[model samples]
Target: MSDRRATVVRDLVRRLLDDADGAGTAPIVQVGHPVLRAAAFPCDGQLDDADLAQLVALMQRTMRAAPGVGLAAPQIGIPLALAVVEDPGVDDAEVARVRERDRLPFRVLVNPAYEPVGEDRVGFYEGCLSVVGYQAVVARPRSVRLRAHDASGAVVDEVVTGWAARIVQHEMDHLRGTLYLDRAEMRSLSATDRLGAHWASQPVPLEASRALGFALPTPAGPGGAAPR
Candidate 1:
């Protein structure tokens, strides 16, 4: 880590320790926070096992409490390259078919990186814990090859597809100081309540994409393979 990044990590450690006693969720830093804009420092074994484990646990708790699929360190105001992801698994058959979501065991990623596995893309409504209260139509690669370390510093390398891949990309972008809105159809952005009220049933609305001057993927047949 650079001197500046080291300083940032030191400050983060102090802040985390100060709040260690607090109850409830860790405060998620919002869009305009400087920490969210700056590229996070690579963990690179800088944090000892105990501290690393504690931080990962805190992040997992915060993410579950938020009821979100993923969380990145920057979202909780830590400028470190770390993230946690889990999906209790989607139960609705239709929802599951559309999203290709499945049960994902809780996993930790440190100093992570990913690359698109194919030209295929899936466009869907995505919201963020940090962004809060809005959802937008953003398209991302449907599969990715990931490389990272577990909380114990063990190497992790795998290919992930479907909803899990989207979660990975979203969280990784946080560490890179990017947001879904940066790649979303701005005109298709909608309030959370409004989405549930009017757009919840549609996988991807054609009218919304037309209004936003973009085309979304055409749905494959029932039980068909994911959009390519």
Candidate 2:
């Protein structure tokens, strides 16, 4: 969130916008990019409705193609306080019941922020489109109150629970240049491909913690199981 980083993000945004011409998917910015570490500019009045709509559509398309549940503007090199999220969910009833993950409709969040709703938290292996190929266990609040504006500039204020809340927090962190790794349990970090071979059966990080020889921070009381 340094001034230099912010300046770099702004320059990148301008360059990306200038070059946008109904082209193919905008390449997702990778983990080491300076723009990904910079706080984003607020979306208010930055683009007219038409441009904003176009940009949101582009983001949605890119996110869907990535097959990810959420995407932040900075992930695509446009450091604006905007993101898109959606989760069609998996068909496994057991996994869904444990993770508290259900289907979430697509949503566009502009200048979104979240507040932890309670003391309860859950640790789950989380991944990011920007930080592709790796996953790690990060503890997040079980629920949150989200405040933001939708694509139409309408106010959005709601309390989301379980997996939906996690998605919100993950995307909101991007606006502040915060990646999940910033709050992850480093010992539990694993390559995406190795998850099925090692940690897929463990509903929580406890087993992984024991296997990896690292202490897993226990959540406050019981709330929900870990992510898949």
Candidate 3:
């Protein structure tokens, strides 16, 4: 993230938190933003600042509000070198053992750089919040290596396979100003013609209750709300 944009986000988030009216929310620039076109600012030095902290907070709230599992700084029009990933814990050992393979645990990468280490593989059905109404099938590596600086600025190199690897690669692309659309072989805006299923699906909510916190059709029934 550029120091300039980071500074802006820090101030902006403070304003939003104080009022909480939601009027001070930052606008996510669409595909037309000049910042999205070319280069993403690199972290010049230590990322210790209010902006970095604010980015993390804003990203979390934005992701939750938008109902997405992961969100990056660039998506919100702040070109930062960080991303926030809320892990949906899955039984990885069972998944990997089923196929006789190994996969790493979930991680939150900051300033990550992805490089192919082994056989190359491609993927599709990537959805971007910036292109909200569209879904694109892009091809990226099936296995990859990542190098990044930790919160303390210590260099750490990691490796992984399968979807976990894909997540890092996808986020790293954002840090470089490249969207999955750039690498997509096929693109569509929600299964207009040739319909296909997405490899990764968005998380679905289980249920929604009203403001009164009562189950539907349950004022005095078996499923009625108990005394608080």
Question: Tens digit of lDDT per residue, candidate 3, span 1-228?
Answer: 556776765564455545544323445557777656655566654345554555566666776677555666677765557766654545555434322233333334577787896555533345666666666545456667878875456786977665566667777777788877787644222441222343222221002122212232212211121222
How far does residue 79 in candidate 2 sit from its true spot (Å)?
A: 1.2
Q: Model 2, 1-228: lDDT tens per residue?
A: 556755665566556655666654678989999978989888756566766777788788889988899999989988789999999986877767667788999999999988999777887789999998899988889889999999987899999987898899999889899999998888888999898788887666667877876554454344454323
Which stretch of 10 consecutive residues in model 2 shows the poorest summed lDDT? 219-228
Measured against the true structure, the TM-scores of the candidates, in listed sequence, are 0.89, 0.88, 0.64
Off by over 4 Å in 3: 1-27, 45-47, 89-108, 187-228
Task: Using TM-score, rank the candidates from best to worst.
Answer: 1, 2, 3
Is 1 or 2 the stronger prediction by TM-score?
1
> Which pairs of residues have clashing backbones in candidate 2?
none
Tens-digit lDDT string for candidate 1 (1-228) = 876767668667656855865444678888889988888888875666766777887888889998899999999888889999999977677778768788889999999999998677778889999888999888788889999998877899999988899899999999999999998878779999988887777655555666556656545433222343
- How far residue 226's Cα lies from its native spot in candidate 2, in Å, is 8.8
